[model samples]
Target chain A: MFEGVPLTWFLIVATIMFFIGIYGFLVRKNLITILMSLELILNSVNINFVAFNKLLYPQHMEGMFFTVFVIAVAAAEASVAIAIIINIYRRLINIDVERIDEMKY
Target chain B: MLIMRHELLLVIITVILLLVEIFLPDNRKHTIILPSILLFFIVTVLGFIPGPTGELFGGMYATTPLILTMKNILNLGVLIIFIQSVNWLKKIENKGKIGEYYLILLSTLIGMDYMISSGDFLMFYLGLELATIPLATLAAWERFKEKSAEAGVKLIFTSALSSGILLYGISMIYGTTGSVYFREVMGAFNATPLQVLAFIFFFAGMAFKIAIVPFHLWIADVYEGSPINITSYLSVISKGAAVFILMIILYTVFYKIALLWRDVLYVTSILTMTIGNLFAIRQRNIKRFLAFSSIAQAGFILLGLIGQSQLGMTTVIYFVLVYIFSNLGAFGVAGIISNVTGKESIDDYDGLYRTNPLLSLTMMLALFSLAGIPPVAGFFGKFFLFTAAAQKGLYLLVIIGVLNTIISLYYYLLVVKAMFLNTSDQPIAYFRSDAYSRIGLLMCVAGIVIIGFASPVYEFILSLSHGLY
Candidate 1:
């Protein structure tokens, strides 16, 4: 049982982490850093899932399964993101998010 | 008896395409496109075959009439893409690496197939990721172009962000209902704040996929930078898949909570359309202009969600059917002109009809359909959507929709004016299309023209849309 840590605390921490990721996403100028921010956001969701699974449906283990899937997807997404960033770097020789504004309207 | 007929078909075709590439002689590698197209053409026909429809894999995958028809429609879209892409795909620059294109394209189609047929949250999430990750690579398929790579990065990053938000919402829903299966959650959910919040987050994620107004920042840039073939794929098939699944979840799982989200949709619909039109007017790049126009079209499609009745479903299906042809025809013309002349701006299209009469005329018909002109497929589609909304007594939405149509008309006609009336010193010269591309263009033209006059497609769509309620 989660004797000491309340459910609200877990929810609050996860929410905070999610927003932290968003803040990082907004402020970071490097593609790699922005991707890292995205990872943070996904991880926060995983935390919420795991916590809720433990709190509610401990018998089914649904949330834990979702967490594992999220982890796998995040890995796949990160790899793809890194590949694209590298592709950009190869062409432009810079990975700054600001410089990636070439096609913006 | 695997029961996943459509997904299996997609996979078998993907494997065959990939396998064919390995054995192909270096000089004849591009010939793989022919087999791939032929195979897709077969699948499009096979899609019409009746198959058993029910949940398989312990309720993870479900096939219904709606999903079957949607899958077939998507197959048709992919088939058209193969036709439109062949000549451009076989150019010398695309020589050896052609297999990679079809492989990813087929993989994305498979993902979308599963997404449409998915019966639970786990499958939905998996299918969505499968559909999304390959697209970034496809957007950046022209690796040498800086803009292509940029588009890929933006696409992946934004999709990742949206997926995370969506998962958080899913977690909330799981917490509230203790399940992710549609059937189970539908019974348990009662519009709790947590569940409502979950739906909101989930909607926002899909809205990003559809490139709705607030989350539409990446669309113009992505469309501009991506290869024209992939741009058409994104505008039509990808969007159609998302809309198909979005309506499914909304009408089935979220129906009980409709009152709460209806207002949310109303505000976003108006904002999405107005902003799409306003931004579309100023776009110089034809691809970016279409991007905004598609965004506006997304807003119009959202009107279908307002009613959640069979007529609403009918309108959504019909409109999407028309859009797949209309948008692709326009992009195909743009692709043809740009492939020949390397022109991306509207100014480059001035007096295009003087030389390339076929391309210009097809472009006019497509644009006219998109503007919802009478006697085109698009008009009936929009008419039914408006009728659906009006039946629900949402007259304000219909009125706003009418005004947005006029706003959209101005820009769509601008292209027509530039193509027909405006004259340039040097016009784009007439070009002969390959037989396949001609067939593809003719197919779209046929859809734009013939579908309006024919009631069979409409009736078929209505039959498929049945049983949702």
Candidate 2:
């Protein structure tokens, strides 16, 4: 039971993790790092989902079911993203995001 | 009897394609592809019959006549894409890998089918990921090309970022309303500041897909960087499904907060059109130019969204139908040229009519249709969208829309003049396009010319709607 733990604690922690992931995504120049940040952001959402399930809607398993689906989707996304990153690396011989602008404005 | 008839057919087709990949030799792959294309077309057509609309899986899955019609339109688009890509797909690097292309494409199509027919947020999110991940792979399908790889990188990261933002918003919505079902969400649609913030984030997520002005940074880059078929797929099919789903969600789930969304859409419509047109004028690359043009078209679609009436939605559907034809025709021309001479910029079209009159003519008509010239379906589409907005007393918005059309006309003619009137001693050599591409182009042209004079298609599109307002 999450009796002693306030819902606010989960929400606040989740929000902090979400912003940190966003900050890394925005500022990071490495492709792999950006992807890791993306994973972090998705995981933060998972945390929010699970917390909401435990706190608010334990009767229905919708939130937990959604969290599982999100995890599966994140796995698919990460696999594809990494495959693309590696493909880019083969062409440019580097994974630097700044150098990947071959078709920029 | 299975509830999701089309999805079941799609899955069966996917399995057949995968089996074809396994059993067929590398050289014999092309032979099986045509049959598979025919099979997909047949199954999709057969699946078009109207059935009982039902909600299965406790409102997670849904079926309706409108969803069926939209799915059929998407199938039609994919069939054409198959035709359009055959010539490109037959090249050396892609020959044996044809099955992979169809696999990813069919999987993405399945995702879109799910996205449109979903009754709840969970199904929508899963379907979206299923569609998007493969699309990013397809964007970089040309593995050796640095540009294609760059496009793949850009698409995946942008897509991941948007989905992340969307999930965060969805999480907040769940926390507040304690439900993700549209039926339940509508009941709890209180326009609190927190609710509005969540809605804004949710809209932002969809906006990236629709390529509205603010989140449109990825459009031109990805369009220019990817191969032509993928560009057309992204601009038309993917965006079409996203726009269709966005309309349904706003109309059904967020209908209670109509006033809030209408105001949000009004400013978005005006800004989207003006800025899109302004940026389009400066484009040198043909793909990027069309990218901006599509952004402007998104603005016009948003115009129809704000009218808050069935007539408004009818206008949107009509415009999208016409838009698919017009935009694909333009891209088909670019694809042919890119294949023949590898020229991509607007300047490369100089004196094209002198060398290749047929393609040049097609290009001219397509560009005219895009510019909303009379006797073309695009003119009617835009006319009706503006009228819909005007009927809602958004006169200033209509005026901006018209002005954007005029500005768009100028850039479209820039390519036209270069193709027909400009003289060049060394124009691109005349080259014969493949039979499949020619058929695809012919379909686009026919849709553009005939769908305009004919009134039945518009009426049918209107009839398809059960009533959003």
> Which model scores highest in lDDT?
1
**Sliding window of 10 residues with minimal summed lDDT for model 2 chain B:** B460-469
Every candidate's DockQ is 0.89, 0.88
> What do the candidate models score in CA lDDT, each in turn?
0.89, 0.88
For model 1 the TM-score comes to 0.98
Q: Candidate 1's residue-wise lDDT over A28-93, tens digit each? A: 998899999999999999989999888768899889999999999999999998998888888888
C-alpha displacement of B388 in model 1, angstroms?
0.4
Give the DockQ-based CAPRI class for model 2.
high
CA deviation > 4 Å runs, candidate 2: B1-3
